[model samples]
Target: MADFDEPLCGCLQDMFSCLIVFCVPCGGICIQAYSVDKATSSGMVCPFLWSCCLGCIGSAVNRGQIRQKYHIEGSFIMDCLISCFCGCCAATQEYREVMNRERPK
Candidate 1:
């Protein structure tokens, strides 16, 4: 059960993240999809295509992949539920995870 390094609400602490979460047509979600693409070794265009094609399911799959990579505790069902219900929040959390991990600590 790998724990998230940052709080889910950590995005709220960052101006850009806040914008991403609040932005109606989220560019943040795209950024997160790109991030996941890199992390999963998926094609650069895959996430974008998924976002355009599958919408919430794309981001949910991305989140599931990320969780798998990090050994985080979650299931696909949960990912779908979260992504379906709170996509912005889920994207914000995923974006924070990607950004925080990439930064030099």
Candidate 2:
């Protein structure tokens, strides 16, 4: 499986996403969830609530979904760890991955 286009440590590379995550992590996550499935309100709200109540699990699940969609190489355990410790960074990384991959080159 291919790796994510942007590494987790590269979160700071995108100043806009980095600042969004740093200032309002849940909003960052909400943006990601919305991007993934724009048609569904649950897709947006569920992850936002999850991040609010269970930071690691919510973001981990969201990360897993992104990984699955892009066929990126990673595991839920690692996602949980990253989300648990580096929630903002992870969110920013996820945002960058989606934006980079989906945008036309």
Candidate 3:
């Protein structure tokens, strides 16, 4: 997974460098960039020391637990029923069509 700072840095460079260096830093829902802060912004220097800093923070919040709400039977024949809603055919197209037709009008 690429980080988010690379594209931003590339953009800044392109905007300042007469739009010469084109950097497409994003691929499949992620982007990365490198940024620096100093007494003098070296736009150039690798001239100075290039420092790469990366970090990730993730958190998970649980919504209270609920019991599995399915009728499970111990027979293979019944397994098929559970898989397909106990033999009740899902009228996917009909349902969608009715929902669409009933909208507003």
Candidate 4:
């Protein structure tokens, strides 16, 4: 099972990210997806487009990528549901995970 530095309750754990996502969903999603993918600006376009136009698909894809990269214990369907229903929270959690991983260990 994949280990997470924090649980999925990013709203409770990360108020800043949660607030950002809540205020500007598209920008927040773009930043979170881009950061998690660890890619250049060109690569950020796809996720940014998807997130801006198709939130469900974008969030699901981003969550799936993060899960696979970290061997997180979750199914694609679950990721979809989370993305569909709890997008802000999910993205915030994913963002936190990426930030945590990037921090010095």
Shift in Å, residue 100, candidate 2: 0.8
lDDT of 3 by residue, 36-101 (tens): 111113332331121111111000000000001112113333333322341111112112222333
Any idea what lDDT model 3 has? Answer: 0.19
For model 4, how does the per-residue alpha-carbon lDDT over 1-105 read when each residue is reduced to its tens digit? Answer: 865666777466777777788787475786566656662223666766667777787778777777777777888788889888877778788888877776678
lDDT of 1 by residue, 9-82 (tens): 56676677678558757575676676686567786577767766787787778888888877789887888888
Greater-lDDT candidate between 1 and 2: 2
- The global C-alpha lDDT for each of the candidates, from Candidate 1 onward, is 0.73, 0.75, 0.19, 0.72
TM-score of each: 0.81, 0.82, 0.15, 0.80
lDDT by residue for model 2 over 1-105, one digit each (tens)? Answer: 998778778976888877766676366676666645532224576767766677689778888888888898999999899888887778778878777777778
How large is the C-alpha RMSD of every model relative to the true structure?
2.1, 2.6, 23.0, 2.5
Better lDDT candidate (2, 3)? 2
TM value for model 4: 0.80
Which one wins on TM-score? Answer: 2
- Pairs in clash, predicted candidate 3: 3-31, 3-32, 5-32, 5-33, 5-34, 6-32, 6-33
By lDDT rank, best first, the candidates go 2, 1, 4, 3
